[model samples]
Target: MTEAEFIAALRRMPLHPGAHGLMDDSAVIDAGPLVVTTDTLVEGVHFLPQDPPGDVAWKLVATNLSDLAAKGALVEGVLLNYPLGDSAWDHAFLDGLSLALARFDARLIGGDTVSLRGPRVLTLTAFGREAAAPVRSGARAGDALWVTGTIGDAGLGLAIAMGGTGPEALRDAYRRPQPRLTEGRALAPVVHAMMDVSDGLLIDAARMAQASGLAVTIDLDAVRLSPAARALGGEDRAARLAAATAGDDYELLFALPPDVTPPVAATRVGRFDAGAGLSLFDTAGPIPLPPRLGFEHAAPR
Candidate 1:
């Protein structure tokens, strides 16, 4: 659908009180200490048509929640932009959506839904209240780069969901990506800057470095990856590189001063330098990162 047509269709649904009548490029919600993030997933781009409808529902919600989790935001409320499908399919999708939303006691505050004549596209604008806004430019040099749990699972999970499966252990990684909500909140007060690893570790770390005007040197071997990542992710080389660059692992990647340790379990993967660039150190000299990074849906499928 055209942009205007899409907007018009969505505006017909029940909207948030602060959506400004669905006219502007921004929404003004009354959520105090608001932390806002919007994410979009398109059919044939974000997910395959043959994939289970329940999983589509789950990942759709998980991805949006991941953005909120990255910002250290609680699930205060959400505005969903759903491209309505068959009634039975919609019913099942809501069931899956409910499962994921219930995990954080979050609900759809208000949103717009409409029937689309083409592939399904889902957008979620989520908001959470924070006592203080956590910005990305707060990271500092000498601050430790930490990752909660493992990385590369979601990428591998996506790989499995597509068709090729090196192992079954990777299914949960793709189907249900958990946002590090607790870890984000715990570090917000102490950490310099925080974001979830929705993209590859290398890319996200570089983003933090660029935003903070610093450099990030990652210890590739120090990265945390699941067994499946080691297996299907090209065993050794792919594992390291994919762990370095694979996107969609919704774990927390945060920065903190050298002396301070996170109150939660984390792995120190790297350090930020005073300069502005990304270096991956894996026993040898640092490896330069490419510019075309992260998961881009608008690009070629």
Candidate 2:
């Protein structure tokens, strides 16, 4: 079954009391406002087999933290699911995992390790604390949409890792994504809605729009691209569209009142409107929606 189908199947089963109806990325527990999120990365799927094990470990931790960040929670600890591999690779992964946890001020309290005969799979469950988890469904019409950092850098980074030419910064972005933990917590109070842009900018925005039951009109010219991404994607309508649809950027995308300036570095790229669906436009005029929005695991057969 496809990933979405599998998730849907799980939703049909009786859910744990704290489960968020399988709607949000993380689930909230009744115990002291704890929130938890889990993500799994598989070899040759999420990451290239040739990718460094240390980087893989870094990504595994950062991605889960990003989910917690979206909930406006402070990460307290993580539970690791590590599959044993060769000694050297396993050691490298542990070292990287240690550095990542240290950097985020989170501890690895507990986990499971087991031997696997197939592709390497790494999973992490992050625990966080917050009085209330921010909801993506909170966006409203007339909210200004904003995105942290530049978009499309990670997509270019993936290309560099795949033998395509690119700068090291781009490659580093793809390998080690910086989760917006501090920013998420800071913005939670003022923003109307918030979510991490792990997928493409356009697709994630569409999700927020759908959740809010409003239309999102994105101005393509306002979408930010790194120097490396600009060089790789060029400065045309199609190029900008390509950047918008490229996924794996872990920056936070949010909506706020137009008068409220973001406390952190961000760019205003769009606005939520009183309608359903999403619309794309540029300086010249409206642009046609792409056939495919972003990374879709369960595509129509």
Choose the strongest candidate by lDDT. 2
Clashing pairs in 2: none
Off by over 4 Å in 1: 1-31, 288-293, 296-301
How many backbone clashes are present in model 2?
A: 0
130-195: candidate 2 lDDT, tens digit per residue? 624767888888999999999888888998999999899999999999999998888877788898
Q: What is the TM-score of each candidate against the true structure?
A: 0.85, 0.87
Candidate 1 lDDT, tens digit per residue, 1-301?
4445545644544456667767765566677777777777788877778766767878877777776776767777677778777766666666677677677666555566676888988887777877344667799888889989987877777777788756766866777777778777777777788877776788778888999999988888888777767656654544677666778788888898988878989999999879988877677666556554566442121
Give the CA lDDT, 0 to 100, for residue 158 in model 1.
75
- Give the per-residue Cα lDDT of candidate 1 at 133: 47
Which pairs clash in the backbone of model 1?
A: none
